[model samples]
Target: AFVAALIAGEKAAFHEWEAAPYFEGCLPVEVMAERGPETLRHGPLKPFGLTDPHAPERKPYAVVQLRQDNKLGTLFNMVGFQTKLKHGEQLRVFRTIPGLQHAEFARLGGVHRNTFLNSPKLLDASLRLAAMPRLRFSGQITGCEGYVESAAIGLLAGRFAAAERLGEPIALPPATTAHGALLNHITGGHVDAIEAGPRSFQPMNVNFGLFPPLAEGIRRAGAARTLAKKQALSARALGDLEIWIGRHPAAAAE
Candidate 1:
């Protein structure tokens, strides 16, 4: 009942779509709700195959799911809650979820115009053009999503090219590091769709899910669970990254 009221009260504003093309595939949740209140219930919030143990006799009116954002499982994204809601509004609205009453968000969801390649199908481990090794790709064009992520790819590409020119072999960065995790996604970390039509790969920013999973015994939630997990992942990434940098004398010097 509270959830329904929150959604009902929420209002979103947008510039006229006539001014710019809005891809039908990524319509905001509130926009879909405008079609009819039940539209969302039939679509993203349909309650089927799920029964709450605490209230087995009661059927839920709606449901929401979260997707793991990184390999470490430290972050998750709301399954179908993309919006134009102001940041403060988003926190208030989303925090109303049963299990997320006190949830901490690493990044709030938003929509944007993004350009990226289906890199998993096209690029090699070194970000080199598979069909034409004479050329290399970097940054957002290569499918990395954020400023930090794009800059990291550019740095890696420059290093790879310099190593080749000097007749020295440079090892790929350890997948545990932020740079390696982002690069891995560009090259082959993403699985390809079997349908063989348009690719399902989407542009993504660096997050914990991209890195290799943490060792066992670090997966439970207690007080400060989210913060502790992120700290552990960051520490591991830095350690692995330093070791990788040490392997290349030229890279280390620079």
Candidate 2:
């Protein structure tokens, strides 16, 4: 929708009006074409490559190309390829390529629907994510998800907005907490918050997996269990968050 408005030279506000159930073929439009060409070029590829065919330098029956999966040249696979199809089928279809017959895949792609509010223009600094702070969006809608991560957002939004109700200015989290990381991801972690790009603004989920490693030996690390590490971090966050909450009891209560 953003790109469409750009092409027509107008401000536009359009969203996925309706999205139904998901299937291997239905996650995104491009996923279906991998099954066959008749379904492909006429469907997802239709009129997409229709740039002056009269030119010699341009030629494509249907194009699906892969880029190096890493800085090393050991791997490559289909672009936009996401599937639950069996391994035999994947290898047979994908190996037909010139350079990737023996290519190894680190991970196959997949997709899921993520509902989110247009937060930048819609919410106050409190993370309420609405024109009115009384109504706040949370979880996948707020663009944060996970057992503890979602709660951490609530911990902040609850306390920050609660502070507002008690007539104190909203306080933001220090950038060390899981809550803070999620908040940053939603607000500004990539390009400028208002700038546009297709690859820009992918939704994020929180985990220690997302945390940048502490400089090799800069600090003594905690337990090795991934789940335990997240829990330990959560315990510490709740303590600091409670102090913030106490400052604005009413907002946290809300």
Candidate 3:
């Protein structure tokens, strides 16, 4: 009943909201709900790995996980609960979770409109604004997706700035490494598809597709081929990353 109500709940902006496109990676809960009754169950709410202590024999159909919002652990936030429902509706809906019947929210959920830059066109190799080298950009604002990717960019930016301050050569990470692959993607890897226009360079999560292929003779036979290929890539990436790190001994000190 709770899931059904959430699915049927009145969203704050019914008309204008429908016209705006949603990023595939962060689709709203109600938007997912509209796909089918079981879409949410299979996607965000899937209960494949978790084992309930009190009901070990019976598998859970769905699960909702809350995350820590602060360092003190006194505040918790729902993990994938982004929504546009009214405050009253949000409280009524979220309180339906098993252990959260009496849950008190420190902050009711809300949505924000986010804007990001087209980094490839606007930023240089070291992530400085091309037209204004005095400024540098990193993280999602520069178009790299996810926490890890954003942090990697931040680390690179810091290193580049430090190298400039110390009068050292700023060595870019090798394209084979994860950091390099992502940096390359945001800088120049993804060319806009003429037909798709701006959508061609849609935000992306790091994956093997972004990495350059393995060496010529590293092929494996039959069932082992796929896993073997991945292993080769991982090994190569790590080795290249080590070499890149070694070149920046000044960065190693910090």
Candidate 4:
């Protein structure tokens, strides 16, 4: 839904809305922006002096607007005139009008500077640096895209690390389990390696794809059904984890 803003704003996706936004309601932002900065503000955002032209209606110098973009769309994003301008520029230019001059930034404008390593080239199955087995990484830094994906990596890293410290021959979670899928993605998915401080890792949350499906293909169901599936998987995983722990507890009381 917000991808249009994300791209148009360049590094300023969220901040593009500091003032009123442009209209990308029917067209692509890239296409809209090509029409010129004011074109969008006037068209999509044209403050038609319509709200109350006779009542000292304050017309917007120009407008930045937003519109619904998807079928199941419950979200909206700013359209055209995306920029890489400084934070001050947005406040000054966007805030130049009547309604928005004092409009506070809702999401704030900013930039994204992403980095990654060639995980396949440096780490082993447990996410330990092959050259420094004592260290492990989890979360987004490991290269899983979403928040849930990252948390799954953290869970597995903890399990594998605990088992290793206990001096017990370790066994992986059943490949047909939630914990197992997460571990599988991290130990050998799309991650590269961290060349700098091992502490420079990212963060994330968890979800179903991280788990193996239920016996009857339950996860594909709608909202209520998916929620039910997650609850069941959590209970099953916790019980299995306890068993694994009993046989090979963490040596350091972690």
Candidate 5:
């Protein structure tokens, strides 16, 4: 019903004026609904670990989580509910959710554009601009998505700059680690298409897909294989990260 409402309300809520490419990590609810009925169920509305007290045996198809927004506990936030729907349409559509029929909203959700650079084309491994090495870029501006990724890039940029200033060698983390994988992604992971006029580099969150394939292939098949692969990757990443830390005592101290 929620997905249906979003699709139906899209015509009234969304129009030409608001059309723009959205960050994949933070897609609008209406846009997600347009993809498929199960998209939201698996993405934002996933009911993985919850039970209805009124009817314990019957499992809920989806769930909406409200996060406390203020100290008073009067205001609550709708988790992962960012939307491009017009104000009236948002009210009309969102009310379709169970238990929100009489809910009063302190504020409505809206979408905004995120600005990012094509880091792979512009920046070096140390995050210094290739054309003008004096200037260094970091954070979301350098095309790494999320708060932690931005901070990690900032830390690396700072370390690199400090090393240069002190006449010390700038050490890079191994690619197996999350920081290294993300850094590689930002600096030179993207491959430009042969037919492309401009590089299609985009901001990305650090994910297992960004990491290199395992050194040794997993022989097992099915869910067990997937689990084993993840465990192996995690163990390898941790071991590599520890070695990297040991090699760079100054960075480890920080």
Candidate 6:
């Protein structure tokens, strides 16, 4: 019912006169629903951690998470519920969720355009402009997606610029770390298409795919292989990041 309503509401949603293309990292829920019935189940609605207390044995088809929005915990924000649905349609469609039958909304969702730079082409490894080294770039504008990704890039850029000012060497984070993977992506990770029209580089969130593959002997093949690979990658990243921090005590202190 939720999936069906989302698809229906997507068709009815009011788009701006010149609606911008949606970012791949932050797609609208309705757009995900239109792809397939099970897309949402694997995406925002995936019940990865939470379980119903009353029915412990039963698995949920989907889940709607509400994040606390206020200090008092009286207001809650719907996680991953970005949309462009009309106000009436939002109310109609969202109410279909099991626990939200009488839910009062603090605000309706809306869409906005996100502008990003072609960072791979324009910036160097330290996030300095190729043409103008004095200028530095960071955040979503550098094409690294998500709040954490943006902050990580910003931190790197600040450290790099400060090192230059103090005549100190700039040491980049190891590629295995989440910060390094995202920085590498923003700097020069994307492959350019043969036919040159617009650049093919897109904003991206940090994920395991960005990390270097595990050594063949270290990796195992089985149903648990995927989980095992993630654990290995995480451990490697943590170790590498600690080494990086140790090498750059000033940056770590900051």
Alpha-carbon TM-score of each model against the true structure: 0.54, 0.39, 0.81, 0.45, 0.89, 0.85
lDDT of candidate 3 at residue 215, scale 0 to 100: 67
lDDT per residue as tens, model 2, 135-207: 7655556656555666776777777767778998776864455666677776554433453633334456765
Model 6 ranges off by over 4 Å:
10-19, 194-199, 247-254
Candidate 4's C-alpha runs over 4 A off are 1-85, 92-108, 131-135, 145-166, 171-179, 190-205, 218-228, 247-254
Candidate 4 lDDT: 0.57
Give the alpha-carbon lDDT of every model: 0.78, 0.55, 0.81, 0.57, 0.86, 0.85
RMSD of 1: 12.0
Worst 10 residues of 3 by lDDT: 193-202
Q: lDDT at 107 for candidate 1?
A: 86
For candidate 3, lDDT tens digit of each residue in 204-246?
6788899998766555787698788888899988977876778
Question: What is candidate 6's lDDT per residue for 1-254, written digit by digit as tens?
Answer: 88889877744445476466778767888988889998887888888776779988888888877889899999998888888777898999999999899999989887667788888889999999999999999888999878988999999999999999999999999888999999988898777655765457888999999998877544567857888888889998997798787965776666
Q: Lowest-scoring 10 consecutive residues by lDDT in candidate 4?
A: 197-206
**Each prediction's number of clashing residue pairs:** 4, 2, 0, 15, 0, 0
True-vs-predicted CA distance for residue 106, candidate 4, Å: 12
lDDT of 1 by residue, 163-220 (tens): 9999999789888899998888889866655677544666778889897887855656
Between which residue pairs do clashes occur in model 2? 162-251, 162-252
Which 10-residue span in candidate 6 carries the lowest summed lDDT?
A: 10-19
Kindly indicate the candidate among 1 and 2 with the higher lDDT: 1
Ten-residue region with minimum lDDT total, candidate 1: 17-26
Give the number of the best model, judged by lDDT.
Answer: 5
Off by over 4 Å in 3: 14-20, 53-55, 70-74, 194-200, 216-227, 247-254
Error of 1 at 173 (Å): 0.9
